[model samples]
Target: MNKLLCSILLATSVSFAGLISTTDVTVDGVNTITKNYQFTPNPADLGDLSHDRATAWGISGVSLANGETVTGASLKIENLRNWELNEWNSLFIDLLWWAPEGVTTYKDQNMGYGYGKDDDYFVGKESEFGTVNLTRLNYNVFSGSDGMYANPSEGVTISLDGYKREGFNKIFPLYDVTIDFSDSELATLTSYLNDGNFGLGIDADCHFYNDGFNLSLTTQKTSDVPEPCSLSLMLIGLTSLGGAFVIKKRK
Candidate 1:
């Protein structure tokens, strides 16, 4: 009887044990997803005096088990370039999540979505995740302290020498920007994935010239474990069984 009880307890503990796994979510190809965008300054634009453009990509092929829980997530952007002619010209990059009603891919428009006056640009179609300010556009120097800047309030990190330019006209260089999601953000992302509405929107002012970028997502998931209350009840039941068996043996 003791051996049987121990076996049952061991089996229960194993059943409730949590298993962790990592998943890479990307588009275009497995482990290799990329998107290219070119923003040209509209000299005749009246709104904001700069042309703001937004594009979105929907993530598919995400498969989660029934009891899987997303614990952490991150988004990585590679090879971001800045090619504004004006030295004082800098732009803000806004990361957003497209609403369920929003279009996943470019449609009806030639150059993605253009920002107009007020919040009329986003309205009820998209929600902002965070914003990154690209400062010091004129300086060709490379360093995190001088050339690269990231909004700390947005909970994102910009690596050193993230901005690069070759010769006089080439701004293409290797740099990575990673955004780590908080706990609450992970929960929201999980819900979007479950609904098949997981999409990322990139909105930026017309400062970045023609450039291609690679994007990849890292996600961590944990298998469901038994709740504390349930485990406590199970322990109580097991203790009672042991007590009853001991009493029977004494008799």
Candidate 2:
């Protein structure tokens, strides 16, 4: 290979940034039919990592294809742990398979996870950025290190750009929003959302990603209905329907 030509190609490739192809599989209502992303890393970069015991773990950024081209992918996890079961928080995550990237996240990513910050003492957080209930575990998602959890007001919409600038960029790669709390859900969601742009806010720096993700799940909140906010939607819908009926009657 010509040294000068190789350098030129590399530079040009980096400048364009490729795209990741995502796909979705339909199942039914209320439940999902897919999860996770899949990608084939550069043969050279794949190197010995695939076989390296030390490198045996979840996917990495290097897997991302050049020009937005992704070599692998993950769920857009936000508040990714909850339900204090035993002595650790139940890990949480979201679906990112439908995000603009060609990758199957679950089968490829889950190969390496569950090794806690200190020994195997906690539930490893999973994908699909959504509400979690880690209070049961008694331990925060990130205790020793490389741990993070989020709690959020379910059904609410938020802009992730702020979270991105604040370090929640990992969860914002795709614009698809998921609301799940189980490992299965994580894998399912990531696989289904393989090509969507979900605005997720995950702060992956701290061993705990302690960005304060507060979610008002039904388990914790005594009242399902928050006062002053109940009558808004139903009332509006009913009123519109009534007006339409009256107009029809006059005609």
Candidate 3:
């Protein structure tokens, strides 16, 4: 019985650690461009002066099983062409989730959908983050506003310099921005995942000479495993039944 219980306990032991990454950037809806700049400072009517532009990227199919929790979430964005590291002071990044505004799926990447920034240049369809004005757009950050967020008040802001990584041949720098989710925040996130509505949004705030930058989201998930004591008790009950069966057979 003791050996049986030991085996059962060992079999039930669980450890948690896994990461999910999606690069499906070719899809038009998944990759969104918001032209927000109203007027060009220089070049004098060469174009519409649409210098104020940003990108919002989302990763669908995010889910957490029973007893699982999201440990962390981060966004990796490619640096602008010919932009050196010293010019990164003006850059900013934000992480967001789909608000519970009847949004069943994350595939809605249309121009007016919640993915794009609501400004004079473009308009968003969903009301998950309210209007596209600067007040509603800027949330949980000291500076820089890209798009509207469901709960901007409930986000963690970090320094961009801390998560920077070098690309191939050190040509382009990949910036990693981590999102710190609290206990309550994790609960809310899990609820969304369980409901089959896992959609994460990433907003980048910077001035780029061209629209060649790339964005992606990476999230780590951990499951809640049963305690050792609980498993021990369950194994003991099963072992007792086995012992009784052996006694009956001997009799």
Q: Pick the candidate with the highest TM-score.
A: 1
What is the per-residue lDDT of model 2 for residues 127-244, given as tens digits with 9 covering 90 to 100? 3222222221113334533323334334323223222222333331111223334445434334333333222212111122222222211110011242445567778889999999
Show where candidate 1 strays beyond 4 Å: 1-52, 85-123, 126-146, 150-154, 162-175, 209-251
lDDT of 1 at 16: 11
lDDT of 3 by residue, 1-251 (tens): 01111111101111112233322222322332211111111121111112243322223344454554454433222222212332221322322333221111122222221222443221242234211221122222222222112233334332222222246533332222234455555555555555543332222222222222222223333334556687799999999999999999999
TM-scores for all candidates: the values are: 0.46, 0.17, 0.34
| Count of clashes in candidate 3 | 3
Error of 1 at 178 (Å): 0.8
lDDT of 1 by residue, 19-119 (tens): 23334454333242222222221120111222344434333445455544445555544444454432322333333332222222222122222222122
Candidate 1 C-alpha error for residue 225, in Å: 8.5
Instruction: For each candidate in turn, give its C-alpha RMSD to the true structure in angstroms.
Output: 17.3, 20.0, 18.8
Best by lDDT: 1
Cα shift from native, residue 20, model 2 (Å): 6.6
